[model samples]
Target chain A: MKRARMENELVSKGHVACPGCGAALAMRYVLNVLGPKTIIVLPACCWSVITNRHPECCLEVPVFHTAFETAACVASGVRAALEVKGDNSTNVLAWAGDGGTFDIGLQALSGAAERNDDIIYVCYDNEAYMNTGVQRSSATPWGAWTTTTPATHFKGQEKKNIMEIMAAHRIPYAATASISMPEDLMAKVERARDTRGTRFLHIFCPCPTGWRSSPDLTIELARAAVESRAFPLYEIFDGAKRRLSLDPAPPAPVADYIRPQGRFRHLDSEQIEAIQKRVDEEWLSLLRLIENNPA
Target chain B: MKEVMMGDVAVARGVKLARVEVIAAYPITPQTIIVEELSEICGRGELKARFIKVESEHSALACCMGASMAGARTFTASASQGLLLMHEMLHWSAGARTPIVMANVNRAIAPPWNLWSDQTDSLSQRDTSWIQLYCENNQEVIDTVIQAYRIAETVYLPVMVVLDAFILSHTSEVVDVPEQEDVDRYLPPFKAALTLDTNDPRAFGSISGPMEYQKLKMARHEDMMGAVEVARRADDEFGEVFGRKYGIAEPYRCEDAELILLTSGALGGTAKIAVDALRESGAAVGALRVRLFRPFPADEIAEAIGDAPKVAVIDRNLSVGAGGIFAQELKAALYDRERRPAVFGFTGGYGGGDFTPEVVEKIARRALEMGKPDSPTLWEAIP
Candidate 1:
């Protein structure tokens, strides 16, 4: 397929995002895909601080920094105001982290989705509350070690299925993408931008700092998660139709993904085997869903 | 045109006349009718606006704040628990300088689930830095909502127009609704000085350190301090356009009086009647009704009091450990005066209880015999 003209760099160098920050790369891809005619409403997340302080902003588009649990509603409001002003060309994007999407901001996000507000909401899932010193969030995978969930008593529950939760809202569109493939991520963003009401994109991001892995392993871990069926890439349309964006041709062992992260180092062989079984079941479930729905 | 409408409905009329661009609110008792009326207006195409019915008051205010930042005139309404729920965004909106207008029905706080007229709900948020205006009647309710947009847009701060639940909110009265043409001549369309726009690309509400943070706070304070004057001028301009005006702190029959009765909100009307009865009985008494509470209007209040040897202040709200809020703040306002009157603080008329003229008369006669207050709060009977 022939591509459209190249876009300008949106995320400039002045941003405070850390070294090898998958969130930074994801933001760069999303913003560049949406281009300069976009407004970003950021809630309390790593990006809220990583976007830098007053007297300086690194993004090329206008930004509105809102309260902790207000990203979705605020984005809806901005979209409403823009429409009232007779300017429908500018896109409203709500960029939030895992905690903001799955925990504190869940109600507001649900409200916006229920209203089918005209905006794009992207949740960059870093797996934990990495901004506040690696606190355990609902997004944290089971058996992961966080500050709140110590190594002795690791996380005992499953990570929240946020994409499914958003799809349940029956919004116009919802999709899952990973930073491991910039082309796929940007393609999903273009699809989201082309759509109208309440498009949700869940982007899997690897946090080397919080995961206690080497900075160079960020992209590799992101890729391994997809290759190992730990995180699958797919799209849901109108909450009814589903299609697989990427189905790994040859699935790798879950240990190749989990073994590198120190947060999951405490898991024994038995625990790892249980995780692999669960992953296999979930992957099959997703396949059945896509086959049945047939987008 | 003359119309008999409830205070909540009057608020809707004021908003319609002001040509508000966006309204986002949640439904709570007494405050519910404002949004209901607005939704009908929007649906009928009588008012060109967007009405977003949110799930909670927190989201309501958050949505309004965002719209305001996007250069749209915004409004919201809540009461009691709902207002309490919006506490964080109240401070956020003011600090962000969004200039959103909100109406709060003064309902009693819960514990026993009382939902009648009380000032404590709005008063509890005095420190949030939003300009607060308490009204005595439906007329003031409408006028203040219109004037609030003017004052708030001038100061770059949010405004809260408060009216007693069930008293002004549910009750009906005759009001001269201003024509839209007159209101348009008095107040112009909102053009946000600082806003979100992709054309220019600006960042708002970014994190800041002490060096810039404190200076921003000081600027907020200074502009807030200047808001009363802006409000007075707005009222004056409205009077010029529509032939009606109410001062920030209105003095009634206060010339050469030995005793003064000060009150706020709906209780002010009862106090005035009691003052008139006391004067008929050969007592030198006067009435002063304060409208503005956040800036406190200390200079205007002190000027209104003017050499009265005694003051009897009736407050409908409490601070628990502290006494009546208005009386306590009144003392603070008069402390710098060379010959401040001996202020007698009286607390009652809360929790949906009736505050009659007889209660004010009794309090005045009781305070008349005393040189000073025996206690911080003198009671006129409230359980």
Candidate 2:
């Protein structure tokens, strides 16, 4: 069956995003789903510079470019202002990069989540600080070689479990999504849109420049990532009820996901095996959570 | 209604009268009570505003900026360390032209963990393009806060209403809180000249080329310069409605004075008392209490201090490498004009020490004997 095209003039044609930029795709799908009545608070990230220079905007929605580590709190204030202005229908969205969400902006995000502010927060996880010349961030996976974590000194620490952190806040809806699966991604956005309190979406956006991968393979690699259980697609409802969007059953080997990206090119066989072991352990841990919550 | 209240409570009352739509603040000593009263007012539904108990001062100001960008009248208060933490967003709010009215209880900056009154806290942020209004007492604190909205909205610049920590913040005084209807008639609801509207989708704070960036900065600078007249008119109109007016700079008994004490904040009140006592002693001295610090009120100040042989600037706050901030700015303001006085800068009353009228009298007596300032700042009450 032919899938009808989902389109909105929400994202203009000539945004300065890199080709095959999953972050750009993620923004498009999110904006299309959320519609033009949405206001986005963008922090210091690639998109901060990507959305055309001053006096020229690239989106159909108003984007409030704010300081780093301020997206969530700014959105909280925006939502409150909108409510006071008798605009309960307009969506206030906080869009940030992984560094902004998982590291510098974590406190603000937690503050908003704890308050259960009436806003949606989306952290488009590009896995590293792709905006600032591919620096290592907390979201940079183990064994990934960013500029800061170079050559022999690949990222030794594991990617921070941001989902668990947001879940601990017990917000109304928290979900992990991927640009490879736009339908499921848009679905989660719709769910978040319907929810009144703080809704978080952790979107896996593979960076072509930062990952040193061909632009054409961005989506395929994103799909491979989920199938290998490297970045599972799941949701946590009120921090308890769990549901998987896509089952990583009979999962492909982690190497299948790792081989194409140059960021992981320095990994030896033993390192890959260790990573695979970690992946399996994490997958089992997630499966148990899904079973117990049974959403 | 006439009710005796602390300066903090008067600030909260003034914010309510202005009908501020959003208030986001973090608790800081000397500035906490203002937010506390606002929180209770918001909680009890006495004031129709959203009060966000933000986690940090940085978030407090950032939240205010966001709310203001979305076309809501926003307010926040912080001092000393909290104000320093919000330094970056201070520039952000003003550069974004948010028109957020913030009350800053001037507290001494740390190193020794001081929580006393000091003007250095807000004076350090002078370049951030925020219109700074220094109040002499609780009456001026409330009046300036309500007038801040009008001044800020008119010029599209943020306004910081500054009062001395504890000297004014905790001190209770009989203040005639203006009626809300009167305020409403005096100042209308804020309608942003440009806003983040769903009907009009646009991106704010996008990266700009140097040319456009410089142009924006220049435009903001021009508007900021015009805020003095706007503040003057707003205060005049506020007086017409509420029957109280504090000019940008108030000159008292300077008509035939031999010496004039240039002062700001609560020190102005003390200076007035000191001037009256000096007059009783048959000294031809007067007081010039400057209410507005930014858009400096140079013309009014220069005119007020005309031919007064010696002008002693009582600076309760000092700049470490330089001298008193107001004294420094005053020299610059008077440099281009003729008929200027030998300005004697006396720096004292830091770390919350009492800046008594006696100290003012002592400083004036010392200035009366001086030909000109021996140094940039004379460290008073120090061996």
Give the alpha carbon lDDT tens digit for every residue of A1-295 in model 2: 2342576658887789888788998998899889989999999999997787877778889999999999999998898899899999999999999999999999889988998999999999999999899999999999999999997888889999999999899998999999998888988999999999999999999999999998999999999999999999999999899998898789999999999999999888999999999999999999899998878
Best DockQ goes to which candidate? 2
Locate the minimum summed-lDDT window of 10 residues in model 1 chain A.
Answer: A1-10
RMSD of each: 1.4, 1.5
Interface DockQ per candidate:
0.79, 0.80
At residue A269, what lDDT does model 2 achieve?
Answer: 90
Model 2 clash pairs? none
DockQ of 1: 0.79
Per-residue lDDT of candidate 1, residues A178-197 (tens digit): 99888888889999999999
lDDT, candidate 1, B326-365, per-residue tens: 8888999999888699998888788877778888888889
How do the residues B1-383 of candidate 2 rate in per-residue lDDT, one tens digit apiece?
89999999999999998999999999999998998899889889998999988889998998999899998999999999999999999999999999999999999998989988889999999999999999999998999999999999999999999999998999999999888888889889999988889898888889999999999999999998898889999999988998899999999888789999999999899899999999999999999998899889999999999888889888888998888989899889999997878888888888967778888898888888887787566555531
Q: List candidate 2 segments past 4 Å from native.
A: A1-4
lDDT of each: 0.90, 0.91
The lDDT, on a scale of 0 to 1, for candidate 2 is 0.91
> Once superposed on the true structure, which residue ranges of model 1 sit more than 4 Å away at CA?
A1-6, B378-383
